[model samples]
Target: MKYISKNIVFSVLVLSFFGISSLNAQNDNSKIEQLIEKKRNYNQTEVKSKGYIIQLYNGNETKAYAVQQKFDEMFPAYTSKMKVDLPDWKVQIINFKTRLAADRALNLFREEFVGANIPKS
Candidate 1:
């Protein structure tokens, strides 16, 4: 009889714990939802702007083309283009609106290239 009563008491304690946790979970979810709504409202007034790009390479047409292809394979997310201006071939990443944003990218590219510069657009 004592064994049965102890089992029953344990079961009730476990059930109460789960019930209390579920209530707390619901409250947490409501708070998360409210925060998300607030963030969405704040982002509605966000502004958009333009920046500069980092020049990766500049040399012969064939060499620049190969470098551009390799760079594209390495960083597919960035816009890498090759242009011919006079005697040199230009490989540049364009449209970096902010100096801070451009500098962040410049630091990453500096590991691979020595001539990475954030030129204005």
Candidate 2:
């Protein structure tokens, strides 16, 4: 009887330890998930600020035109003309309300241009 009680006590201790560890692990996971969601919301809000600019480029005029055409079709009335800071011949499209909006428009253009580059709008 003494030996049986000792064994049961040992088993209970081990189970208790594991249960406590599992609870801690679940709390940690919840905290991590909350932090991730907060970060995502913050990043999205930062990019969604209106009055942002975007720059896009391509070496070929036909390629540039193709990208522009795609943007026109996908995001009607979203594209606007802007000039690069320097006097380079490359034309810029701009006039987006938010960085996220610019990104959405640029992504649409990228599908067509393939190699064309776009800066944050």
Winning model by lDDT = 1
State the lDDT of candidate 2 residue by residue for 41-116, as single tens digits: 9976775444655445534565455556665566576654534334333445666665567677667666654544
- Each prediction's TM-score versus the true structure: 0.55, 0.52
Assess candidate 2 and give its TM-score to the true structure: 0.52
TM-score, prediction 1: 0.55
The prediction achieving the highest TM-score against the true structure is 1
Task: Please report, in order, the local distance difference test score of every candidate based on alpha carbons.
Answer: 0.84, 0.64
Model 1 stretches astray by more than 4 angstroms: 1-50
Root-mean-square deviation of Cα positions for candidate 2 versus the true structure, in angstroms: 4.6
- Superposed Cα deviation of residue 47, candidate 1 (Å): 14
Cand. 1 Cα-lDDT: 0.84
